[model samples]
Target: MSDPVIICCAITGSVPRKSDNPAVPVTVAEQIESSHEAFEAGASIIHAHVRNDDETPTSDPDRFAALKEGLERHCPGVIVQLSTGGRSGAGRERGGMIPLRPDMCSLSVGSNNFPTRVYENPPDLVDWLSAEMAAHGVVPEIECFDLSHLFQAAALHADGRLPQRPYCQFVMGVRNAMPADRVAFDAMLTTKRHLFGDAPWCAAGIGRHQLELNEWAIAAGGHART
Candidate 1:
């Protein structure tokens, strides 16, 4: 088999207190600059979110469009994957950003609570978004917060809501989500069990679990970048 592909950077995510990482980009320029840095580091694909002027997250179509224009201008052929599960707005509200026609976008296969609030995604909403995305020619990278998310992914595929060659990102180590272990191999196994054999998969662990799971995902015949 050919070597698994590598995703270059996760880029600037939505959450994470500014105090934690001053490098987290919050504005248009910052997001683009960070994308450039990550692209140069050998990342051909990026998982991205748009932030407001004050460093808060927003899924504005204009903002997403701007990023698309800028990234394509500077780095052509770099796949910019937009995060549909934006932090601030309602998940459905965030869907408005789809007009930008990103090469790839996220699809949260399940929901879970994070610290203060709940991240909500349901079947109807998922089905609607998946259909809309297909019409727009956008690829969905199913985001899995836990094992159950995998089930949802299967169901979506079975129902013909999602296209084949499903792409999933196993986000382990969040508070209520799967724990991120220091053992890379263990993390890989946990992901593999849910993903089945040889599906296009990526793993991430927040906070202290980040590096461990990331490295583990990369070594375990999966691609790792952000």
Candidate 2:
């Protein structure tokens, strides 16, 4: 029997805009349509970030609700994962949509340097987000931008904060964060295995390394995110 691979599609990120590609969905309606297309193309998970009418990212729960509603109506059983990412909001505002109770949400357990600024996920905020996820029954997709984050996830799980063996996603090639290197990828896999044996995880490569990471992850018998 073939191993079943779960494909996760990030419909619209907070940083990209329609101006960047004319195809980047800025409105909720466009995002729902894009998600439906990806679902038809075999994506079982939809990772989304809501936006304002002016194309700026927002942590508006209303917008999240509308998008969640549309995705449920159009895509049925596909998992809907909302972004509690920093670009969309600051502090607790990022997790404001957690109450909407999507199947999962992105949780950054540590801070890392981005291209121009610090992607600050302070310990207190991380604790808050984790607590919120626990309260609302939202599973967290641990976004590990650096190697320390992998350990952090393990610690969180051990302490009962994460509740489950984490479904970690190694995020690579993000400017000042961990780069897209084969050695680093191998180390991540090794640590994941040590921490959670045979558990499912995923990898994501930014910019030009995206397809490469996808191939590497698949060959390694893990999951890939595009």
Candidate 3:
């Protein structure tokens, strides 16, 4: 296929720490440096999450602004997608960075079981985040952690809550959430095709399933998140 694949580099996640790998970018400077490297390495998008001095995740917009500025200066046309995931913040605070007007931001349409607890994305919060994204002209990358989420995205799109063409990302291998199964992956593709037709989509696999899911998504003609 001649279609260009958009590679998204998640510089640092909320859960992983320096203690986990010693290479996780914690500070804003470190995140910028890592994002620059990823941009140079052919990643067209930077999936970012800001952390405090204590290496804990925060929803501080200032930190996101610094990271966004650095990425725009260093990476130029690279897409900056800030994480609105629950681990970074709670309630509306999770979308505090939306006003910064990043190129894109992740939006989880529904809740699912995380490793230890529920990754809650209530209807109200999801709607609020969607509105924030719309107000800021920031595109929402719908994170689908379960089959129901795909339908939820469809409903949101139908109601004009999500103005964009619903860019969904399937997240697999989380403890009590979806697993990295080939059959399930194919089913998701089928459902996406039936619901959204040829609209662009992506996938991410947590922990050990990352590379496997990347390959699977690429081979299936979908974007892969690394």
Candidate 4:
């Protein structure tokens, strides 16, 4: 039998704001509230990203600690997965937020242009990030945005950096990268072909294609969001 899927509700992400969805929470209290709501909605895990007063992305350990405490008290053992994808080029956000020592944290396995800006994580930085996760005993959730990125992730695994059965978050459909269609779908399949032996992966499509890619992942004998 296939393993049970882990549904991770990305409650209030860095990109989404109150204007987009009035229910999108920005404050610590509101975040807790939204998390509880998602929990009740059948999400056993949460993919979180913290925001500052101005709603900018912030890797504040205190904020993470507060969320952890609230989850422990109210949710009672729900997994909190943090995003290492910083808003700006400051690579510090990923390592800076490590004091929380979350059960799982993301590792964007490759560099890609995010809209007008580039999200850089070259080989050296990736190795460092993986080693840090290992040192802290936290599971690295490999976030792959392209086929080559998946290969890169496998390369890291081969070099004895990533875990034995690593977790993957395959992102599809972004500008300046893979498109969001059957052609993009094939690329994801290519990724699976390479990384399949090394990990259990969950997939997501950004922007308008989120739902479609998610469905593809669910149908293809992989873990997926409900």
lDDT value for candidate 4? Answer: 0.75
Candidate 2: Cα lDDT at 152: 96
Compared with the true structure, all predictions reach lDDT values of 0.76, 0.94, 0.94, 0.75
Clashes of each: 1, 0, 0, 0
Q: Lowest lDDT 10-mer window, candidate 4?
A: 86-95
Model 2 per-residue lDDT tens digits across residues 30-137: 999999999999999999999998899999999999999999999999999999999999999999999999999999999999999999999999999999999999
Tens digits of lDDT, candidate 3, 41-91? 999999999999899999999999999999999999999999999998999
| Candidate 3: stretches off by over 4 Å | none
- Model 1's alpha-carbon lDDT is 0.76
Cα RMSD of all models vs. native, in order, equals 2.5, 0.9, 0.7, 2.0
Cα lDDT of model 2 overall?
0.94
Decoy 1 TM-score against native: 0.89
Model 4 lDDT per residue over 1-226, tens place? 2666777777776887777788778888888888888888777787777888888878777787887777767776788777777562266556666657887788877888877778788777788788888888878788877777778877888778986566777776778766767776767766666667535678777778878877887777556543
On lDDT, the stronger of 1 and 3 is 3
Query: How displaced is residue 55 in candidate 3, in Å?
Result: 0.7
What candidate 4 gets wrong by more than 4 Å, as runs, is none
Provide TM-scores for the models: 0.89, 0.98, 0.99, 0.91
Local lDDT at 128 for model 2: 94
Pairs of residues clashing in candidate 2: none
